[model samples]
Target: MLRVKNPVLPGFHADPSILRVGNEYYIANSTFEWYPGVEIHRSRDMVTWEKVASPLSEKRLLDMDGALASCGIWAPCLSWSDGLFYLIYTNVRSWNAGAWKDTPNYLTTASSIEGPWSDPVYLNSSGFDPSLFHDDDGRKWLVNMEWDWRKTGSHQFSGILLQEYSTEQKALVGPIQKIYPGSEIGMVEGPHLYKKNGWYYIFAAEGGTSYEHAMSVGRSRCLTGPYEFHPHNPLLSSYGHPEIRLQKSGHASWCDTPDGRSYLAFLCGRPLPGTLDCVLGRETSIVELEWRDDWPYLKPAPGEELFPSGAVRNWPADSFEPPVVLDEYRKKGEFPPATKSIEYRFDGSAIHPDFKNLRTERDPEVYSLTSRPGFLSLRGGQSPVSHWGQSLLARRQTDFSFSAETKLEFAPTSFQHLAGLCWRYDETNQYLCALTFDENLGRVLKVLTFVDRQFMHYDPVPVPGDGPVWLGLTVQVDSGRFRYSPDGKTWRILRPVLSAAVLSDEFGGMGFTGAFTGMFCIDTLDYTARAYFESFKYTVL
Candidate 1:
């Protein structure tokens, strides 16, 4: 069952920040490492939205020379103050490095919703997820997730802090003081403070924005004093509810529906059975807000909402049917033509280029194939980031267990003309079960499962010798096993190692990652003599 409005927006959209100017509205989400930072979407009603401009489209604003997929952009908050709109976020060099180890927080502004935004003003590094909270007294507070890096057996850099903003200097005015740390409230990031019922309420994320995610709240009589975690905390979350389709629903920011009615807009990483992974990052979602006895609560009101069912049109009939499932190549009469083209979009990153989203830069001569022209092919990535340099025409891995099948023609050669399906999460994670060509050995199917920073090869299975060979994969995750096949029907099982990190919530964030997104995938060949997709298919088992 899918929500009609499920996925709201696709392709790595995350870290939603909304601002109401007049009758119209604007929302900004983090666009990490991608050349254009902070994508802005405009909407009149709470529903429909269209892309505007990246706040850092100007060269003076920010630079992302070596930004990784989930790094460059941090939590972004959008607010309109004094006829000016502001986008507040942190710019990190790379997630592989660690947050704030390099670039710090910054702010950019524009006059109109669509803008040539102003250059950035550096903010402080004691926090991330920089948000603008304009008080009634005309003072604007810049609150964010406080960052700490004390290594006491656990990983470094895990704590929350808060501070005040200096609009004149475009920086933090006073020394940042710790608001209640996330440990105190069972959450750690995306902190926002609002006033209701004479008490200051704090909304934060817990479980590090992944599968075990939740929206927690606490209140304080003072803005920067002792805060109390709600008795019924995780106000708007499915923390322990396995049935909820919304995974890692945190880093929340709240907006109102005019007339003073409040609502919350946050990003959610929708998990599919296969073909799509959470690494595509997060999608934006909306929920109503209400106050009980003066304290604010996230939508569905404490034990009252359905998982993945928060839409006006959530009936299965109203939603788009899921894509056709495919597991093998060469499926005789039951299959599509040998080749078809697909259309896709990219955030201008080296992984997924701006023009073609289907395929990305895999090697010097090829990129990952997307749906372009009539068929997708490899075009070498001019720009490279991490190990994603391999041309991969991939879609997100939605289901844990499913089959990915494709057709490729390989010429017997020494240099590997790589073609096949892959499961990827970031530069260091994932695996490839592929068809590699060798002059002597001919075309053969293989399985390579990567985990714990190690790529282990399973037994190589030979396929029938042909100019073009069929390749298929059965990556069954529910049982924690991955297999491969030559034809689309039969399969071979490979042993599994625990790859919890790829399936966890901490890795998801903006621009397909900020808070949630799909994993890196490719459908292109590297160092190819020539290869063709008779057809490509992914099926959820």
Candidate 2:
């Protein structure tokens, strides 16, 4: 037997849709406001996974220009049938507007996972979290959660709708039906349909995506009729169990092994030691399931307790308790080892697959690897807060304690030309240690921070010459500080320690993504200034 750690895919991977083709398993995750809409990882043994593709790579398939923070792609569903892979996703134009949400869902297909995928076909904007179900009768159907913005709170998630999709016409046809209205646990979404043992089952996410989140199931003998809820409604949840290492556990997808074992892939968050802040974001985890009396339930690992009381109990609607911090919970070795270290030399022809840009695809006008051989050349564009063309490349900050170092060769004649390293959560919340120009000093290094829309600038240190300079940032749990080095060996502290807690989902309030650390260049003056980054290195502390 193989013992697998939780969160096989870490750092911002959420809303997993798992599918198996032949002997290979694939999991596609949502990428909110980041470009390359969906993240797909593949695994052969279910214990180790590697990123294989990001399907929505072109702007034609996904256009998210000016998309606000946490408002882009929601839950993406990936399925396979007839030697073709189907991908369905939502492009949320606006979600924060009062009593209204513009969520337009679309569908795209590819013969292979790593594709030249076809342009997306527009589906319905009536709701989000769309799924494709290929029935055994050689017919296809689409199911999605209907959003009623007129209603408030949990009522906004009205119900799940089902309709037949014509493969030949490439569009939805026939009458739509409300298959399942959802259980008493409201805020239903992320619907997935499956067939097992002469029964059609529908699984959905309920109780919002916060601490009270859970996965509920219902089954029906017929395809379109009233469904019966499970005897134990919520199939899986960590609602009141604050002692568990994984929190906000729900939004699941299912698959089976060739050996006849069933497994579930769900999204979970690991909050900071003493806070409800998940700085690393929601991730994907897998667990085995056992069937009893035609109903499925989680199978606890050896010597592990499935529930706090050793038996499942019905939790009240308002049973959400304040999250408790038990640092010892993670000491049981449930989490995967932290990423030790990585370095990028920019010697290759393309950027590493681990890096991602905000809201837009990688534009050649902003970044290039061939422009300055052996170095990444970034032609500065707008400021960091702009949703338009911003020359920033970053990777997820996976560990609580880590250090990032980068060497930048930039000659800035004005304060508008800035280049350096950044620890960013979104446009509105971030910390930057940049090298720019000063009126009194020719060239200087400074640290700037923005938290909850408030900005602050630290004192600047003058540099003697205009050559390259190394910038460094070290984050220790709740706080972070910046440093600089003229020579690669000697380092000097550049500023006072600032609060790193602000770079989290809890502090940002309206954000759903995690923090990232990388290099950036901003030229608000002319958008023509260029910054060359020699190298970048990150190490987990």
Candidate 3:
């Protein structure tokens, strides 16, 4: 009975939020507009997971400048008591035209969860995945998911709410209470609250994260509720079961181990074989939860021999082995040794400190390891359609027959300047295979492509850029090819191959996002143009 690798925190890790503490386990997700905002992970025996720290780093607990690509951090909620370490998020400021308007939700604290975390306590915009419940007698509650704007009716997702939180008036006190309304199965949003035995649970996230999405539960012995719904309610869902390749499973969180065993760290998706697309977005998986008469169940068993058996087979227990290919930064100052380093999540603010020297976080000496000493400088901002400062540095294409290489030293005069290789699936769908300097093809090499977010195509290729250049991207699932190499063993396929299902979540923006093959440098006219990288391979064929 082993076998557990279902996106155990891979790629664009979505709205998770699992925690344990004693023997160690912790999870936190949803970093919409990227940045240094929420994205934590650590695991002891629940199948190897890495990445820790980053309680919205700072910038006043996250500020994704002009946040747009899926908007800022949402669904955070990580907790621990006595020893302290609590977090509550949602900073989605306007989700485009039809309004989701300035959703502001905050709350932070940390004694150690690998954080210096402490500033940010505002909480309340009346909606969006917020959770915090620690009651035995000490009381404290927050639970959310009530965002109704009333345009015509059909209960605009107006359900699930509860308040009363005041650790001595750190705020959130009184009148909000609505309680259960979800499971009618629409887009119910990610809400989490637990308290077994005497019961008070309410794990949510209903259909609408794409491929119909799901994961529901409800109960209440009065934490302010009349609740009771879970007569076989999607304790976990793969939607219509699409032959099970781990399609869009629901947003979940639950942990228990030290021997009692009861794990579940949800949010799944690994599509691209019979099409549901999902290019590695919304990951983090671990399941094994059985309670019985009190209701919990999700232990069908059998299924684990993973090398991407579509995802979730579970590994990392025989001492913790992580490293799936190359990341050769030469252990410079160490830290990214967990799954073979790359995790540079940044869309804007809160990444300063010589960019954490590497392991995650960038933008200081632009991104250097001793001024090109070992190479990797990346400096350029804005113009990935601007979700603010897109110097971009990615990781998480898991494996569709992978093959990603990088070796650059960019030198361009200005075609709005550039820097290569990308695969994005947000800020206006993406594809960019740049290396520009084209005043009519002087040192060209383009690809562009955007699809559904407009833009269409570009496709140039003159070459002879006078220096470093060997960008790549391979993929073999929904087809994505883009390559180049003046010398690195000869390669040059650029013609029209991209359609990695458009970066699937069904097809770009709003399917909840997934798809992020790294490296970017856009400089819509210099934000102090900079770009330098070397040896960043990724292999898994």
- Name the best candidate (by TM-score): 2
Better of 1 and 2 by TM-score: 2
Model 2, 344-396: lDDT tens digits are 88999888878888888888768899888999999998988898888998998
Q: Write the per-residue lDDT of candidate 1 for residues 1-541, one digit (tens) a residue.
A: 2112444454356777766777666778776645456778776655456666665654567665545555667778888877788878787754444423554888778787678678778877765776777776778887776554544444333545666777766667776677766644353777777776668778877665565556677888888868887766666554554455665566677766557767667667655444234644576666656666765554443334423454221111112211222333114323332122332333223332222122121232453234233334553332112433434455544444555556554443432444555555544455665565545566665565554345566655665656555455454442244455556456666555434346433433322442111122232333334344545555556
Q: What is the lDDT of residue 147 in candidate 2?
A: 85
| Backbone collisions counted per model | 70, 0, 8
TM-score of each: 0.64, 0.94, 0.36
Judge candidate 1 at residue 193 and give its lDDT.
74
By TM-score rank, best first, the candidates go: 2, 1, 3
Task: Write down the lDDT that model 3 would get.
Answer: 0.71
In candidate 2, how many Å is residue 125 off? 0.6
- Residue 500, model 3: lDDT of 82
